[model samples]
Target: MGKIKKRLKNFKAPDALLLICILMAMVSILTYLIPAGEYTRFLDPETGKEMVDPNSFHYIENTPVGPWKVLSSVHQGLVESAGITSFLFIIGGAFGVLNSTGALEALISRTATRLKGKEKLVVIFFVTLWALGGAFLGNFEECLAFLPMQITLCLALGFDSITGVVIGICGVAVGYIGGVMNPFTLGISQQIAQLPPYSGIGFRLVLWLATLTVTIVYIYRYADKIHKNPQLSLSYEVDKASKYREEISSNIEFSIRHKLVLISFVLAVIGIVYGVIVFQFYLGEMAAVFILLTIVMACISDKPVNETVNAFVNGAADLLYPCLCVGFARGLTIIMMEGHILDVIVHSLTGVLGKLPSIVSAPLSFIVISIINLFVPSGSGKAVIVMPILVPMADVLGITRQTVALAYHMGDGITNLLSPAEATIMVALGLMKISYGKWIKWFWKLVLLWYLIGIIACIIAVNIGFGPF
Candidate 1:
């Protein structure tokens, strides 16, 4: 009992996040299982006509069994999606290995030396880079690779590790939601909503820039404070001698073998970027590249090929539980879609609030989407689910689809810093030993303010007839 208690106490934030996600999934499944009202009929997209069927739509459950069965069914598909789970595992494993490699340390050492007196500037630069990169790259994984460097830089700059955690994780999240060039979510949403592909790029660009600026300002203010208050900075507990010993113990120092590992990682990155830019490879192929790269890196580091494969496997093991949890969350989407719960939720909200004027409707839509984001973390996924409803509502309310998109972006961006659903947030919190509640207490005010700024910017943009509006 004592040993079990101690082990639980030592569990990291990522572990906690995974645990919580699992619990939530269980609860969601239970909700699905409960007996409920009769399933309602709706227009089937395939037939473009109204259909009446008991099992075809979601109902208000009065008992638990039905919902749980639906949830279980959805989970099966999500778990079977090799692309999503494997991609997550590969990224997590690569990051773990990279951190253990001391390449991150070298980068941070160089950055610290150069950024000694430019703490505020560094924060702004990184915020802008992450936001822009996230928007362009369209994958959160790209930001994940650079996160350790961001944390090291923040520590060197005398800020709390939480600051780097927030800026890097949430900054990319913000840009991702407000994506200007993203072809996946944004393009799909626009197309489904009867808008042209990349139709509102000019407007989205303005919003992205504005949101990025706001994020930079918020981080810079905090950076200035930390620059002055050394007490708040990261505790650099490892002395130079200890660091050397640790590096040596981990066998992470530069050597002929290590150099080859680094070269392999570099080439992998090149392949990924080229594939993304020129070939437009999907995420599955992108994940395969990373998996293959990790194997190559392990081999080049002098581990036997089989041992290297096992090392990657072992490193990726931690991801399995969390990926399963993510699978459950994905199942929620499938169930909601299958059950028509999504339509119900959207219809209820639109019935009550869809009649407002454009100016009022825009911000309200943003708030609703942001609130929804608390439950659904994937921006692309959420956009797909919500844009259909939001677009029609916007059209009815005399608002443009672009305005609704801007609102969705703002709401999604502002909440990333606070949502426990975000995997990167869990990773950052784990590395820093920061509690989710504590971190939120520290940054909630700033997040709220940033949201306000974003809303104001949206209003201004709408007034100026930006994008489709």
Candidate 2:
């Protein structure tokens, strides 16, 4: 008894990778316990997206997964990650090349220097912009461009990397959750459900404001805490090097070459925004743009071609862990699908909604999408998979599709800040050198608060009949 008690007392939280592995194991075990089931899926002729038929769920026999298959899912996840993983590497390498040329440091230092006295204002300003970008544009990967500057800016402002993570990553995440005019989640879901495009903008804007205000307050409190006592930061032990970052930024003179390089970098970001909005390009095209910018930056900075290549490789290598985490975490979904248990879970949850009161079930839709997001992280993709079923279901229950959209946004959007399968969260934590556990330690409370607020918002929406109907 003493031995067991001592072991429990001394137990350490598993590292991120280990936690993923354990979750995978637990999921594999569940395949045997939960009967394998599925819903009928058909290709939507109009949108060309596959969608599930809610009424078609039924169990199949003898679909238990073996240890070997479960283990192999890790590799399968990597294979599935070719698009996202490659995008991360390319972006990391692009930033790496810029860093090698001293241009990156110059850019950050200039901003930090300019914002010296208005540090808190700087945070609020960028947080608002990032939130707006996320709300309106559904900008996730495109926002990675600002991370280098944001991190250095945090160091210069006398806060640790946590603040930077909050500003850069959390800022956009909250905006994405707002989904007011976001094309990917709200827009796509509305279109597929045959609703007017951008319907519910007023409601969503209100959501954005409420959520963003809370988010700003949440982040500001933490920023103020670290400012008062740096030791209070989640990344404090790792923050000693912050001064070195400051020193590096401090000494650089922002030379003419650096200025030109900075201009080129700015053009690259503009080009990215254009590509996303106009061209509607994705991973491969975006990666190509970064590559082009990298080569251009290296040449203008007078870096030797071979040395530039090495630097890019090294930079991408640093980010490989998070990219790999993305794939590894995806293995959980692959295992669930392979065992045919994914549909069972979805069906079970959605089916339960019919039994509860509209007030109760309406808000619980947020939880529904939140649970689904763990298995499927892509917002547009999730919209395709879920909105079809949820749209019809909402009407049947005398609830509005707009409210379901809100629930879906709250579920799929906010959870990305912590979901293992979310590339944004993984990439941010990887870049900031903060462990997944530390991020959860620092940010989970706010997420819980956000969850409560979302529930309340949903209840209010149902009560007021918030809709285009």
Candidate 3:
């Protein structure tokens, strides 16, 4: 027993999968302790969207998940999350086909060689590009398609996978926080709150600029540190073992095939943006674009049909573990859902936060929303769940609905990278081979910094009456 106790004491560093399972178990247990409750959902006639009626929350029968259900929920989680898991697999397979042609490696090598002394500029450009995509296009899962290429680019530029993650995940994260014109969060949120769409642009632009600047600086500093001393990087060991094809000659020629493949990739990105903006493309449409791009890229690189098929299969196989992470991470939410405790937690949060003074409540809303986002990672989904309650609460607390909206936006964005249940983040970490524990160790400080910025922004919004109302 002493030996077992000693072993337990020494146990450390659970991986993403284990961490997710642990979370599922904890949430399952909470189903009993925390009474099951739900808010009556009503459809907004004007917006034709469902909104949770905050005042209608009432205790319901507890449906606690047993140990067997905890295990079964993992499979149920995968089934429920089939859309995203399959999306990950398809993206993985598509990149698999692309990688087999060596076009991505060749492009990275050529670009890295030419910009050897200008790595800082490259990081800034890509980060800004990703931020714009997120801010304007409401990109979240869409960014998954580019992780392999992004990670390769970072490695080629003498940075680690975490650097790539920051550029992609954190950059987009700040953009989501900014919500300058993000239809997903900002638009859905304002509509639910019965405010004009994109109504508070002036202040939102400021919020965007502040968050973007800090993010850029933070990423640059980290990249600079890791560049100066590789050992300083949290991802140093995992990155060292990464199969990034670093030995590729920098002087490798950018042949016609490589150029064609790269051009096709560029066109594919443009297509995705246009589709999203003009036609309201979601996962299905985006996946189709990637599927087509995969074929175009393979054809351009002159990969034989059989070879391409094999490469695609192998590539998809390589990502099997990471894709599984997505499903397992979803199981956390599934457990909470099966146990019927999600709304109870949401109702509890709003109930507590509603009692605070506006001055205190406005900023604290960020914290409350951050906690709530752990259970509901979907931006639009959370907006529906919390906005109805927050809107009325804001009126009583003498704060603008816009302030609460801002709180929702910033809190949701910041925690996306931090939430273990966020499938996209888990998938990104898996692709980079970074453990969730390591990511948190490296990322918690940045999250704190972002929270500070967000809280200050919320306070200012409250003071300035940031609204067109």
Best by lDDT: 3
Instruction: Provide the global lDDT of candidate 2 against the true structure.
Output: 0.81
Full-model lDDT, candidate 1: 0.61
Instruction: Estimate, for each residue in 1-469, the C-alpha lDDT of model 3 and write its tens digit.
Output: 9999999777667888888988888888898798888889888888788888878998888899889988998898788888887777778788888787777878887788778788877678877888888888899888787777788888888888888767888878978999999998998888877788888888888888888888888889889988888899877887877875366586677788988887888898899889999999888888898899889988787868999988878877877777788788888888888888999888888888878888899999989999999889989989999899899989998898888888998889988988888888888878877678778878888898899998899889888887764
lDDT of 2 at 343: 79
Write one digit per residue (lDDT tens) for candidate 2, span 1-469. 9999999877655667777788899988998899998878899898787877767778888488789998899999989987888888888788778778877677667776776766677678878988988887788876765675677668767788878767877778788778888888888888767778888788778888988889889888888888888888877776676422555457778898898887888898788778888998778888898899988898898978899999899878867888888888888778988989887877788888877777988889898889888877889878866787788788889888878888888888778887777777777776667667777878889899889889998999999997885
Point out the worst 10-residue segment of candidate 2 by lDDT: 241-250
Q: Estimate TM-scores for all models.
A: 0.74, 0.94, 0.96
Error of 2 at 164 (Å): 1.4
All candidates: CA RMSD (Å)? 6.6, 2.3, 2.4
Expressed as tens digits, the lDDT of each residue in 364-447 for candidate 1 is 777777777765666666765577667777767777777777677667666655555555555555555545555665677777
TM-score: which candidate is best?
A: 3
| Sort by lDDT, top down from the best | 3, 2, 1
| Ranked by TM-score, top first | 3, 2, 1
lDDT, each prediction: 0.61, 0.81, 0.84
